[model samples]
Target: MYRVWGFITNYSLLLILGAVIALIWANVDSHSYHTFVEFPIAEHFFIGEMHEGHRMLTLHYLVNDLLMALFFAIAAKEVWEAVILKQGSLRGKKAATPLVATAGGMLGPIAVYLVLAMILGSDTFDAVKNGWAVPTATDIAFSYLVGRVVFGAGHPAVRFLLLLAIADDAAGLVILAIFYPTGDLAVQWLLLSIAAAVAVFVLANWLPRKLDKGRELRPNSTWVRNTLGFWPYLIAGCISWYGFMRAGIHPALGLLPIVPTIPHADRAFGIFAEAEKHLTDLLNDIEHKLKTPVEVILFFFGLLNAGVEFNAIGDPTWLVLAGLIIGKPLGILLMGAFAAHVLRLGLPEGMRTSDLFVIGCVAAIGFTVSLFIAAVAFEPDAMLGDTPVQAAAKMGALFSFGAAIISIVMGKLFGVKKVEG
Candidate 1:
């Protein structure tokens, strides 16, 4: 029993369990679930008052908008450490393939979604058209889980999938920040956000130097460096998040700009040259510290957001389903193949060209970020002004579960053996 508990807690079983409970609760008593999520925690009206004084936020808003910022931050850390801080990240032919594959993975789904939506020629398709970015996200956790089962824990294919997912996530972040907005752009607020990000960068660089000044005074104490390092980053991150929110952008993107500002230790290999390091860069310390809390956040995230009504299914559902399960793999494979031929890039050791398909299939599991994009894409009070359209896009996100199952089956068919480590 202890071993079982350890395994579940260690491997994000709590998060999966939370999602399951959400689905069941949503199906069994959706009104109660909706009420729970909508229940307001607090509210505040500014002295001048805009939009009813920012009404603190419901449980749903808190989870999706605020808490998810950390999730995006963690992902951003991975991308920054790999593509930016790492040596030889963009210089080599070996690094070029996955970068190209990431591009294909993103564009492929958008193309599939647009083409299918155009062919459908329905008013509903037109209403939810912004949802093209929904399926473009690849959920790293679920895909990695599937990949471990199919390719063994140490397979190069699994590593390839991780890199692909990371790159896809970076693409998704750009889409979320650029494509979705709650209102007209507030240029001043956007500039403020940029300033806040720069402030974070400056602080990140400056704090280490300041702490070093005290290091000689308290030669034996690690406390000075550790305590000062974290709080300033947190404060700066909060300022940055607020700037994005006021800028009329999704606050989740707030973390991206600031991530590159965080100090990263120099590394010798390309981003994909070594295995995905769980804890290598100093900039990643924030993500490492928040690992367990992030899991909890993801739990509530799933609970609050995964409760879409199945009856809301529409043409967007099929479009999303096809775009993810079919479009993701097709795009990744084709683009990867193209890069290999055009650039003379090669696959990772022990990974074949055929393995790319299975990797793509596993990459199709677009659960968390996909749902977040769906929420933004078919947001309420948008120009369309159709509540059902939002629900329909969410249904598309919910349907991504089918894609997970298909990936597992596809892996087996593609001869990816489950070798125990």
Candidate 2:
């Protein structure tokens, strides 16, 4: 998996290239657009007949529920590895670059969005305007490509930037689950879901000790056996996610159980024990099976869901673009620098405060999640003018990506090239 990931990182351009090709094909091929809705599960089944949309496993649903679970789980695994398991293993110096930069990058965008929301909240335009926060997203693959590989891996700053970017993504997922999910939920489903969560919680707390069965006392039990002690928790988490979905909440919320509820490390191994040797391996297998088809499903939706049939980028387009491109970097850099200083967590070795200004600029390259929020935030056809919110989101991401690149080049002239120790 590490080799495969490295390969993916090394040739990220090709993955993107493939995505672009798929996107084009999806838009052009009518059959491709319906791919996500095609997977069948069931509805009101008496243990026999198949259902299409009801109990069916659609493409979009699978991507959000199953694949993204692994995505979040894997991310959790990475955070565990970086800060704890691999702590200071890197040449006897722990890397604070990503952890610091990511916090600043994330908080900055959220701050900008909140301020905008407050100011815009008084009017009906608030509905449309509240989405400015949507653009603060930083795509990890793109950011990693630009920061680490494109910028050169030798730069310690780039590695930190990548970590920060991933952390930023984790933050975004939290915000989305909290702020973006639909408020109107089916109460019965909600109750059932809660009931399930409680059940899982009880089982997790009780079952682990039962499974331990004096295993911890045995010498040379091996970490492998400790993992075997965790199956009940894993099973419980799966049940939690399924229940959450039935309860009218986003199923992504289900992955939450896998963390706090599941015991990744034994008392002896401690929480900081790197699960990479085992946990990542399990997640890697799940990720391999899940990511490909989910990607395909989202591509299908992107094509058919392109409701911008008659829209064109216009005046308001320029306004949103300005917010994302101009607003994102300035907000993130200022907040990040302030926090770092206040917290006594200084910048990376020889990296000046000004370099983050460019990093801040790059952070606004928000397309994927922005489009997601736009899809949920706006009604079927509420926004006025030629461009729909969906189109605006795509456009905003493009503008931000373009502007971030420009900022990167321009920052070199004004930013300190090297900092004196």
lDDT of each: 0.73, 0.51
Angstrom error of the Cα, residue 158, model 2: value is: 1.7
lDDT of 2 by residue, 125-148 (tens): 454564644665776655554554
Question: Can you give the lDDT of residue 62 in candidate 2?
Answer: 58
Clashes of each: 1, 6
Model 2: runs farther than 4 Å from truth? 1-62, 65-67, 80-124, 185-235, 259-320, 380-387, 415-421
Candidate 1 residues lying further than 4 Å off, grouped into runs, are 1-12, 46-56, 87-91, 207-227, 267-284, 381-386, 417-421
Best by lDDT, which number?
Answer: 1
